[model samples]
Target: MEYRSQGYKTKKCGQTVLSMITGKSVTEICKLLNKEESTSIIKDLKPFLESNGYDTSYKKVRTFEDIPNNSIVLLEFPDESLNGHFTLKVDNEFYDPSVGVISTYNKETRLPHSYLNFKKNPLKD
Candidate 1:
């Protein structure tokens, strides 16, 4: 998948990540979630992905090693108010919506708090 940027001072990381996964525009994702721009609907993410033919699983982890090679990771930043950020990891590459592709988790100050693993459901395909 291509890297999608949230742009400067935007809280559309969730929307951006969803767009990257679904090949939908960020505006379309916001409308799907019934949300305004910059507002987070992360709580609705799992149900949306599942409904879209994706088999999804969510888990918390202590280290980057605990995260599977290919998954969507929610990284928690030091800031308490902002919701977690999402990034796609495929093998050794990290596709961050805010930045471009990164090789290491250390490049992000945020820590990997949890992850959502997803793959297309064969039955739905």
Candidate 2:
């Protein structure tokens, strides 16, 4: 996955992550989510992905080990609220929209709080 920067500070992370996953521009994602710029607490992400033929499952995680490889994860920054950050994880490497590629979650000083697992539905694909 390509790294995308959240240019609008904290508000754009969700849009940026959606862009990375769907190969859609943030503007397009915003339109799809019926927003002007940001996504509302990720409330629309699962439905949007499902509408696009992606099978998605979301759940809270207690530790990094609980996160499956190659998934979208919500990380909590030390100074941010729970599920305050969104990024992609593949093979233990993070593709953070706020930053860039990171080797580990600890390196970014973020805690993995939950994850969203998505795969293209075979029937839809």
Candidate 3:
């Protein structure tokens, strides 16, 4: 679903994730999607997705600390057993370059093709 955020910009899927990922307010996201009721569009969409064997829902925690920076690594893929493993890389240098392994069972090719570059906070020491 598409949504407006804070007035100046628009966000797609913003309404669904406003409560997630960002963990912040999404007043505009709610208005744009026109789903201000107790139930959410995401809830309706889950079953259709699951019926097709694509589990589009909450996942296990995959943190940025698991990977490194300026790296050309070929680690064993994630979300296997249900399918096969795939490769991932980090290009967004500002933060710790890490990506959550995409589930192959969710795709026909069983190959991963997307990313969410995250940074590492090393100074936690």
lDDT of 1 by residue, 1-125 (tens): 77888788787777777788888988898899886554332476677788888888888886887788657888878765367787888767888888888888773567888888888797976
Task: Give per-model TM-scores.
Answer: 0.86, 0.85, 0.21
Candidate 3: stretches off by over 4 Å: 1-11, 28-104, 109-111, 119-125
Top candidate by TM-score:
1
- In model 2, the worst 10-residue window by lDDT is 35-44
By TM-score, the better pick of 2 and 3 is 2
Residue 39 lDDT, candidate 3, scale 0-100: 28
Clashes of 3: 3
The best-first sequence of candidates by TM-score reads 1, 2, 3
RMSD to the hidden true structure, all candidates: 2.3, 2.3, 16.4
Which stretches of candidate 1 lie above 4 Å from their native place?
Answer: 37-42, 79-82
Could you tell which candidate, 2 or 3, scores higher by lDDT? Answer: 2
lDDT of 1: 0.77
The TM-score of predicted model 2 comes to: 0.85
- Candidate 2 residue runs with Cα over 4 Å from true position: 8-10, 37-42
**C-alpha positional error of residue 108 in candidate 3 after TM-score superposition, expressed in Å:** 1.3
Clashes of each: 0, 0, 3
